[model samples]
Target chain A: MTGLNNKIHQALQQIHAEQALKDKTKAALKQKIQQYEKQKYKTEKRRLVAILACLCLLLIGGAGWFYFTPATTISIDINPSLEVGVNFFDRVVSVESYNDDGQELAASLDIRFMTYAQAIQEILETENITDLLSADEILTISVIGSDEQRCRRILSDIESYTAGQKNIYCYSAASDEVATAHEIGLSYGKYRAFLELQSLDPDITPEELQHMTMREIRDLIDSLSGNKQNENASDTHQGAGNGHGQNSGGGNRRQGR
Target chain B: MRSEQEVNKAIERYADTVRRLCMIYLKNETDTEDIFQTVFLKYVVSSVSFENEEHEKAWLIRVTINACKDVLKRFFRSHTISLNELMEQPEILEPDHTEVLEAVLSLPLKYKDVVYLHYYEGYTAPQISRILRKNVNTVYTLLTRSRQLLKEKLGGDGLE
Candidate 1:
C-alpha cells in the first residue's frame, strides 16, 4: 500500500516541483523585461536632460573651439590594479572612462560573471537596456559589477560539483536581488563559478569544503576566474577579482582600457 | 512567544513547505512562482506588527493559499500553460504512476485541489476543508467521488 501510495505521491510532488521551477524561470524572464524597460526610461530622461542643457547653451550660442564642447573625459589612472569581488548576488557591470580631452568613453565593463550564453543573449539579442540596467546607469561608466555573485561566491560541498572547487555564482540581470519578487532567485555568477572550479580541480574532494567559511575558499578562487594577465580596460572579466569590492575601486576603473 | 529570532527561523524552516504548497495549488509554473513571491512580499510588508511566530507562519500560509487561488483564476482565464517545465522533488518522495497522474490532472480544478492537498500533501479531509473553506462533509464527499473517478479511470484498488 505504501508502494502504491508512493506512486501517486511522487507524481503530485513532481508536478509541484515542476510548477515552481517553471514559475521561477518565467518570473526571471519577466524581470529581465522590466529591467530593460527601466533602462530605456532612464536613458530617455537623460537624453531629455542633455537636450534641455544643450538648448540653454544654444540660446547663449558661441562659435569657437573653446565654445564647442566635446564629451567630458577625466582619465582616473588607478595604480596597483584593484581586484573588486563579484559576489553571488551581483548581476550587472558598467565602466566609465574619462580622458584629459573631457571626452568620455563608456568602455565595456567586466561582465564575464555572466555565462557566455546569457551575455550573448543580453548584449546582442536584447534591445531594452533599461530593464537590464538600473535607473542610475552610470553615464560616465562607473565600473559595472555584472556578476555581483562573484563577490558573494561561496565554496559549496565538493561532492556537489564535478571536480574540486565551488562555482562562482551571480543573480539575474533581470531582477533586483535586494528587491526580488520571488522568495528564491537564481545566482548566475556563483552558479557558474561553482562549475568552473569543478573543472579546474576535478579531483577536489568533498572533505576540503566541510568546515571552511566562504570567505576562506574565496582566497583560493581569486586567481582562477579569468586570465591573470588580461588587464586591458575592455578585459575586466578576464581575471579572477580579489575578494574586496572597495580595495579594487581604483584598479577596477582601469579595467576598461 | 516567538522572539525576532524565532520569526526569522520560522520563515527559514517553512520556506520549503510554503513553496511546495504553492506549486501544488498553482499547476502552472509562472502562477506558482508569482504566488510564492506575493506571499513573501506581503509577509515582509506586513511584518510591522506580530503577536507571535505562529501568527507569522499562519499569515504566510493563508496569504500563500489565497494568492495561489488568485493565480489559478488568472491562468485559467488567460489559458497560457506549461512554460519551462522542471520538477522539484521534496526532500524525499515516491515514484510517479504516469497514467494515474494524468487522470488526476484531468479532474476539475476544485477536485484536483482537494486531491492534491489530501494525497500529495497528506492533509486530512478537515484540513482540506479549512484550506479550501468548504464544509468537512463537502470535502469528504469530494474526496470519495474524486477517488472513485480516479480509480475508474486508472483501474485502481480505490482505497485511500
Candidate 2:
C-alpha cells in the first residue's frame, strides 16, 4: 500500500513538471518573437513618421484658407448718414463694420420701419411712446424667431426666389408685408394690428413676441396675412372687420389670393 | 518622453493577448514565436497613432489576431496535423482540464477563433467584431453554436 501511494505521488510530480515545461516553452517562444520584432521595427520605421508629419502640415495649411479668410467687410465706410445721402435708393438694409485689417468687426441695420403710437388710453398713459415712426437702437437681429422656434416662411422664399442660382450671403428684409409695414413708420396701428393678428396665430407665445424684432414680427404677420407689399390696405381692412362676422368675407379673400 | 515610455510599457503588458491568439492557431512553440514576431512587427508598421496606453494595448491585440490567422493560412497549406493530436498535446499540462480546452480546439476555425478571443483573451463580442472585421451578430451566433458543441463534446444528457 505504501509503495502504491509512492507511485501515485511520483506520477503527480511528473505531471506538474510537464505542465511547467509546457508553460515556459510557450512563454519563451512568444518573448523571443517580440524581441526580434522590437529590434527590427525601430530601425526600419523611423523615417516614415517624419514624412507623414510633413504631409499633414501641407494639408492643414491648405484648409486654413477657408477657416481664416477675412470676413466680407461691408460696413458704412463713411458716416452712415453720408453713405445714405450718397446712395439713397441703396436703403442700407444692413451695415457691417470692419477692422483695420478688413475683418468684419460688427454688423448693424438701418432700415426704415413704422412710427409707433401707444395703445389707446392705457397704452398712452402707462407706456408713453411719442414719435411712433422713429428710430430705436438695435444690437443684433435675424429672420428666424429670436428663440429659434419658428421663422417667417419668407426666409425660404428669399432663399429659393431671391438667391436664384446666386450664392451671395446677405441679410434680407425677408417678406414684402414685413418690410412694407416696417417702412410705413407709424407705431400704434401697426403695433395694434400686430398684437391682434399675433393673438390669432395658434402657436404664438408671449415669449416669442417679447424676443421678436419689429422687422421679424412684421414679416411673419404679413406673410401669414398674405400682403407684404400691401400692408396699409390689409391693416386698415383687418382693423375695420376685426371681431365681427363681417370679416367672414375677407376670410374667403384670404384663400382667394 | 513620458508618453513614449508609457507606450513601450503598454506593449509589454498585453503579452498574454499575443500568446492566446497564437495558441488558437499554432500547435507548437516555434509557430507561436513566428506569430508573435509578425503581430508586433505590424504594430511597428502601423502609421495610426493612439491617444493613450489603452488604445495601444487594443491595437496590439487586434494586430496579433490578424497576424495569427495569416500565419495559420500560410502554414496549413504546407503542413497538416490531425485536430485530435493537436488538441491532445496540451494534456501533458493538465489531463483533468484537457476535456474542455480540447473540445474548444476541435471546433471549426470560425467558431474556434471567436471562442478563443472571447474566453481566453477576454474580448467582448463587440471588440471581437473590430478585431476579426466581422459583424457583431455573427460573432454572437458563432459563440452560441460553439458553446453548444462544447456541451455535446462533454457528452451529457442536457440536450433533451
Which model scores highest in DockQ? 1
lDDT accuracy of residue A212 in candidate 1: 26
Error of 1 at B157 (Å): 4.2
TM-score of chain A of 1: 0.18
Worst 10 residues of 2 chain A by lDDT: A77-86
Q: In candidate 1, which residue ranges exceed 4 Å CA deviation?
A: A1-4, A15-257, B1-12, B25-28, B47-61, B78-95, B157-160
Candidate 1 lDDT by residue in tens digits, A1-257: 34435656766554323444434534554454467568879999999999999987877774432333311111111110111222222322222222211112122334334432233233322222222122211111112232434322321111122121112121222223211211222122222223345566676543353232222334344445464344233223422321111212222222111
Residues A165-254 of candidate 2 have per-residue lDDT tens digits of 211111212223333333433122122334455556866644444334343555677778777779645443443322111121111112
> What is the DockQ score, from 0 to 1, of model 2?
0.04
Residue B133 lDDT, candidate 2, scale 0-100 = 83
Instruction: Enumerate the candidates' DockQ scores in order.
Output: 0.11, 0.04
TM-score of 2: 0.35
DockQ of 1: 0.11
